[model samples]
Target: MNWLVWALLLCSSAMAQEHRDPTLDHHWDLWKKTYGKQYKEKNEEVARRLIWEKNLKTVTLHNLEHSMGMHSYELGMNHLGDMTSEEVISLMSSLRVPSQWPRNVTYKSDPNQKLPDSMDWREKGCVTEVKYQGACGSCWAFSAVGALEAQVKLKTGKLVSLSAQNLVDCSTAKYGNKGCNGGFMTEAFQYIIDNNGIDSEASYPYKAMDGKCQYDVKNRAATCSRYIELPFGSEEALKEAVANKGPVSVGIDASHSSFFLYKTGVYYDPSCTQKVNHGVLVVGYGNLDGKDYWLVKNSWGLHFGDQGYIRKIGRELSLNLGKQSFIPLILLVRSQCQKEESLVNRRSVYKTFFSCMFAEFFTTFKLKVAILLF
Candidate 1:
């Protein structure tokens, strides 16, 4: 054998030996034990730091208060790294959510409301498996596309799966980002309105990899004819809009710790107070135990939320911090003239009198004097 071939073989053998195998570990038990030890140690340190060093009697009375909740499962140190299904579920259940959390609130649903039925798509049907781009904060595109796709189904009666990847990659508006970066849903909606509509996944499949903007016009799928913006922070108004219209695009905050650790149906995030990001969407209001709840669908895969959906009520309003912070989208139901009818009539009367007076020099001079006296 040649010396070069022998050397290459030796190197290949070494590389094979160094390769590591990937194994799945159930780490929920380990997390529970680790948290137990850390909690005890931290409590002691906190007690000493507060009493002997600071000369404080009650730690709670101090200017800063720490509220610690128990964790039944261990959230792995890294994102999506070796967390067991049980641990994820327990973590979601053990969340210390506020009693007045938005999920518990209710809104009135209009009986005569029109909603998207199964037959809206052209012939394709409703698309499933839309995924969430976590931490990257690109929920705005997801929300906009989610509603847009649903609207297409309602109109065409075909369940055609739309591509969120196209919006995230192609939209170059105020709220759009470079795939993984953050963006706002309203901006994405505006982008769609201005640029016709987005393409289907079949036309442009998702790579899960961000690339340069390369939109192909022939692949475009659907277009939005009109968008009805609804009021923010007013559940009554939003519910009414949903009932009257098909769905209204909305934005909400989803940065709570529980939101990140969610793994099951039982949502219990104690730190629901801290919200960090915003997402947009379509809504369907319904009743549960005589209380109203917003049936929110998410772009994340089916494993998250209630099968890629969330139930929020008035208490969970804090989750909509972004919605509250900005001006709500308002869709005009009445004509502009009708909305200002009295003012328009008054302006018309003034214009008629002014025009008549201006046609006559003497009357114009008299009007000037009358105006000065008034």
Candidate 2:
């Protein structure tokens, strides 16, 4: 598949329904039985099994290095172990449409205002329970709604579960949000603003697919006045945004293999690039074992990376601001195929649904990034 072009075997994540030491010969049978994985041909199964074994080796080696403290996180096996990188990328990829940048919205960081050194909206009783986006690439709606949910709670003292599916279905027409294919949080936000308000999840519910619009304004549960775009390539700006403001919507290049089986510890990867593809929420920031980290929430389900939460190396994330829509402001802007990427076939493949290589890259550039996508 193309990634739009690379063909390296990669993985996304789903909680493993069946578990057996990969060293066992019956592990494949157990895995197939658990996830109900099926293939049309015996040869196809052989090819996929080879990828699975390779993924096992990748996780083993990474965890071994982690034991020695060479890395911050450990890799694990999941239901997605049998899939290739291309297939995973297509499923997890998110799209963002850059805003026209309303002249009124400005990211003015008040140097005079004293801000908390750390913040976690979850601890403040603002963020709702972690949600699963299932198989749909509807992360844009989740990211936007997650942030809006926090803002609503912080303002009203009632944590309401907003409807992402509302945006997935109704935010399309004039807003250009592509429902399941993908969308931008800014566009999602705009849809909410224009429609007066969005409905609660209890009212609209989420089916994880493109459905007809049934957005009832009477059931409107939350709304945002406007969305702010942080100054690009600055970690400080991101820190302030999360600390001062409520949970903030952000984006990241979640295409690196390191993020696929990510289970715990501060996630960072040297192979990540400035290719933003997913949208997520940044609920807070703090230090962990001497490493500065950002508390991120994903829409991939409670099984993804530490109970649906992951810590990104906050200090060193490359937040590249391309000319695309949201990139200048830490949102997954357009990564329209830059002529197509070259296929990379490596023994230990490093492909992803969202990548971590930019953590190192961001260190030099001092940028901020985040991730999402179902």
The TM-score leader among the candidates is 2
Q: What tens digits encode model 1's per-residue C-alpha lDDT throughout 59-122?
A: 1222122223232111112232222223222222211122332331122344565654211111
Stretches of model 1 off by over 4 angstroms after superposition: 1-128, 173-176, 263-276, 280-282, 312-318, 321-374
Q: Which stretches of candidate 2 lie over 4 Å from their true place?
A: 1-23, 29-47, 97-105, 317-374
Candidate 1, run of 10 with poorest lDDT: 330-339
User: Which 10-residue span in candidate 2 carries the lowest summed lDDT?
Assistant: 333-342
The residue-by-residue lDDT of candidate 2 on 12-126, one tens digit each, is 1122223334565597788788767887655455557766877877888999999998998777767667655555556765756454444333465656768776788888897
* Candidate 1 Cα RMSD after full superposition onto the native fold (Å): 18.3
The TM-score of candidate 1 is 0.52
